[model samples]
Target chain A: MTTVPVRPPLVRSSDRIIAGVCAGLAEHLGWPVRMVRIGMAVAALAGGAGLVFYGWLWIMVPTADESAKRNARRPASPIAPAVSIAPAVSMPPNQSAAVGPSLWSDAYSPGYPSGPVAPPLGGPAAAGPVGYSSAANPAPSGPYVAGAPSQAEGTAAVPGTGAWFRVRNMRYGKEILLGAGLLLVAAILIARLLGVEVPLGTLIPAAAILGGAAIAWMQLDETRRAGLVDKTKADQAGGWARLAAGLALVVAGVLVMVSGSGSWEQTWLALLASVAVLGGVALVLLPWGLKFWRDLETERAGRVRETERAEIAAHLHDSVLQTLALIQRRAANEHDVVRLARAQERELRGWLFRDPARDAGQLSDRIKAAAAEVEDGLGNAVDVVSVGDTAMTDRHEALVQASREAMLNASRHGGGPVSVYLEVSDGGAEVFVKDRGSGFELHTVPADRLGVRESIIGRMKRHGGSAEINSSPDGTEVRLKLPAAAEDNGEGKS
Target chain B: MSTPALDGTAGDPGRTVRVVIVDDHAIFRSGLKADLDPRIEVVGEAGTVEQAIEVIGRTRPEVVLLDVHLPGGLGGGGREVIAGSAALRGTTKFLALSVSDAAEDVVAVIRAGARGYVTKTISGAEITDAVYRVAGGDAVFSPRLAGFVLDAFGTAPADIADDELDKLSARELEVMRLIARGYSYKEVAKELFISIKTVETHVSAVLRKLQLSSRHELTKWAAERRLL
Candidate 1:
């Protein structure tokens, strides 16, 4: 039987309080809105005066009202600014803050909120609502807004440029940690107001535990999003085990917190011991999680390799096989056919097998920008433009990279002015990199040219895609086509 | 006008062979058709497997020359072409024609019951030759396919060895030959008036000493060796 990925709700531990469980349980049980609050109160009462655990729950889980408001406001609010500015700035819907709601939703889940009220630890100023292509809201400083016309503002984001640092920035993990710390503080303050004993030592250890866990949670969250589909039953089981262990550690920490030393001063030592125990559990669980993650990654890598192999096989079937098959059918001169067949066979037999990597930038901005970067790098006069609104995907990125690589090669090896055009059609997207450079005949080049294989054709073929290089003394035109992912039949053919 | 009268009902005359052509490009079918003599009628042409199936059901050509890559089809769609057709068993023939001459493709297509496997680069003459061959009884594999065909059909036997059975002395070999020619071990025992176990031991020894893997292999070896 196929197992669905179980996304469990967060549970409070003395170590950390992530409101995720209340939300998850709320979601799972289809409970009425206030059920989590009632459940928390009952749990606190049952667990004996609920001093530590109640505080943990209060801090860990977000208020149900907030979650409901966030959910309701999601589709309506965050997208307005991005959508309004999209046409004006010429930014695609994909690259813009159209994803704001989802990103914010994930970030601001009760367990980890990066709102103004719950700043990440060290309290970096929260990113204000951003405008596209504005001076202050340049690609670096501003949230990516889909369909926002970005002209010179986008130029700064080219790699190696001063503005490029913003594009390369990856601080979401840190932001999540800070959010967790803020939640813990808020929880402790609330507990004090509720007339609970506030011990510095207990707070310190609890804070430490929370801080480390929040950091790990953020990184793990990123990793999970990156490619952590449970490809196998064993890995799925590992995920379940990790969740169990995390839950267990949290429970143990709570037990220590509620046990409350004979006096308020001793509470600090208890908190420290509790933290050490929880931290030790997490540390022990770390290797297992990593092991499962690595296994999943390896399985993914293997799948990708298999896909590449299948692609090459298909390409060979298409190019070399078809070419030879054509020659076989039409060759009037048997000797010529034999010679051509042999030559083709040798070429195919030579590179028959191949072994086979990210990321968001709008299709247009990325293509033109990539073209400009290559042109700048190679000192070649090049013109790059997008023909239409292209939905961004790794395949499109690959096509652009291929075109850029081709342009670079033409400029360096072939040597001259290059023209790049990015067009999106119903079939797929194509990046045509043409150059009036010192063009080499296809036969003159070595059979296995790195640029031709890796930068041009290899990238396209990885996605069940295709490419063609036509060159004479006049110029070279590299037509790179990335097949639509929806068109991906999920397996390699040849 | 003497057209060679298509007289013989080769096999299952009532059944129509369902075929699906799975090339991403369309131009190939016409060219392949022209090069391939008019003997085999074209049924349906699909740029991908989905279309191939729709066409297969519609036209139901006896043989499908499936391409490895058709844009929106499953990977290894050559397999899909064969396996998808419910009527493939003992009825339809699949001929995989693609640009790849990889050993894997050859193995895959064959495993998928492509009676014939050839690359897209195969000459029109050879393709016609392949079509006719597949239309007949024999499987038409490309010259490059020789290795794969050998590998697919000639795996090492897993069970008992003939040589081990051959451990019996020369007398046992004679007894085994007699048993193989329809003399049961009991009959041999009765005829030779030896105990059944002794006969059994001799037969077992003979089978072991022959270095054969199975009784079938021993028979085959004996037949090939002309001992039978």
Candidate 2:
């Protein structure tokens, strides 16, 4: 659904002629009377006389909201005469019956025999629900439709009228140019009447205004058909670019004001004063605009982060946690099961560890400290060896944590006195934790056991590695394998 | 290929189950095919998702024995091969094979729709057994995994009693059970994997858990409770 772009309505404070501007703007925006009056006063003073022109322009423009309301209150009048609507005959039935584009059809009839005049669509006190009908031949039957087609056939029909035709961008461009030219001519005539000398320089200001209008028109045209920016990037683009353009314009306007005034000393003083005031305003606005721009960028980043987090969380819950819960629920003895459970616990912690951007030194130190903590927490009479020369990257932390989890599991679950050997190979790192204990027959493990799921195995898998256990009744051996870092050749060579 | 002899049950429709093998190793697949009952039909074989999808589409086997590490392993590992195999997501039940019985690897395959997970070290008969169980929607895992699972799920609460404060230790526990069950002094030693004197010490602790006065009462209580 393409909606016509409407400017924000504000009361016109520069309305010295009457209170009509304030009343019209308030009606357009549906603002309260008191608020509209206050806004007119505040904006006229704060937004400068230039913004006062903006407010006045908004007051003069007929708001679409008002047109919509008026359209609702109008009587349901059929097309004045069906017979005169002959030109619509060649069109498809579906197109002929579809809704008209504008309130013009309901408000005033261009086909009326008496000639087009604004109808009292919405009187001051509009009571009751307004009925809206989209039927194409809605004007009442009379000479209006019958006689109207004959006259319009010889003359040009208004675009977006009757059955077809729409006011395209080209038409809009011409209308804007016509309106701006009229305004320029009016200003020139007014200056002549006031006995002010018309100079070549005077025309320059009008020409600049025309140039600004052309640029603004092109922008609106581009946005109308194809959005000027992606929806996510839209806010930032507007804020940053507008801020830069506004600052440049302020500088250019000051330069123009100075050169336009001929008295060197007076112009210099006036220009300095204006620059100081405008510069202060620009300074205040720059920060506010930049803040808005940054917020837009941050919002986009936040959305990406949230999506990634959800994916990670779902993976953890559906796969890893379920296994741990199963194991913990079915383990036969406290002594027999505690090791796997502890391994799973360590594994869960490792998977949950988030590495923020930090210096290599800080990250490695943190991992080393974490390793020491794991050792202290599990007091096993086992030989523990650490072999890795690479400074910790985020990836390395994940691998280290997985090995630590396996060690924890071996110490706690795999029966017997244990020993851990960490070795870095040419292409990968391997950590082996062996325990002398009774091993079970092959191919009888349960699927949902958590110790295997969460602690030793889960961590390794998450780090893109693997863990294997080789055990018989006499003993058990657990090995963890991880991808070796390029710099870890020194450590892994052994 | 000529059908191998031995277990003619493979050709019996009642015993035969349609199977699709998804391992990368042709040798392993051929070996599995050779040893299995002739009743079990090798419906289709594939080594990768594209091949798997093609074979599965044509054969639509009821069961798939998927290796956790295949050529072009998804995510560059075994678990990824299991979890990210979109070709095996529906219709067919999978039995995962891996050298690693790591809990995460097992969970990954299970979550990927494998009905069971077994280590590659499993014997041929056990693998055959697993296939049947997975086909029947019953789960199977290696013995180590079974112990892992059972221990994980079946932690018995430590039984503590008010009389346990009597300072009778674990040694006394062994002795009490043997004495209550009418075991002779030397016999109790063999049962406990300990010396007869150690069994005697544990019997005292067992007596203390009950706060019982005599062997006669302890034996009667143990007999009544069926602990003997």
How do the residues A1-494 of candidate 2 rate in per-residue lDDT, one tens digit apiece?
A: 35965645433434334535666566657776578667767777875863665554665544456545434432221121111232332212232223232322332222222222111211100211111011111232222223323433322233114312222335356447757777977898899999988874656644654455455555554333222123336644874565556444544444565467555676677778877997899898998989997996786565445434433433343224433443444566554244334344444433344233423453324434444444435534343333323455566666667656655665566544454544443566555565545764335656676665666777778777787877666456666777765555446231
Which candidate leads in lDDT? Answer: 1
- Report the interface RMSD that candidate 1 achieves against the true structure, in angstroms: 29.7
How many clashes in each candidate? 64, 65
Q: List candidate 1 segments past 4 Å from native.
A: A1-352, A355-494, B1-22, B37-44, B48-64, B68-76, B83-93, B153-228
Give the per-residue lDDT of model 2 (tens digit) for B1-228: 000001112112357789888777888888877766666789888777556656766777767777776666344333454454456555667777765444445444554556556655445655665566556554443333322222221212234762334233445433432332223345447557886445434433332233222334333322332100
Least well predicted 10-residue stretch by lDDT in candidate 1 chain A: A115-124
Overall lDDT per candidate, in order of appearance: 0.50, 0.48
lDDT measured at residue A447 in model 2 versus the true structure, 0 to 100: 68
In candidate 1, how many Å is residue B179 off? 37
Residue A457 CA error for candidate 2 (Å)?
Answer: 27
Candidate 1 per-residue lDDT, tens place, A1-494, comes to 35965643333222224445454545655665367657766776885644565555466555555556534533332222222222233223343244354432332233221211111110111212111122111333234222222331342123224222332254334546566777978898999999998896577646545644554464355334323222356545665665566555554445445764535556566767877997999899999999997997787676545434433433343235334434544578654454344444433443343111012255755775565555445545454434333546666667777877887877677554455655454556666666655566766668777778776777778867899987755557677877556653322211
lDDT for residue B35 in candidate 1, whole number 0-100: 72
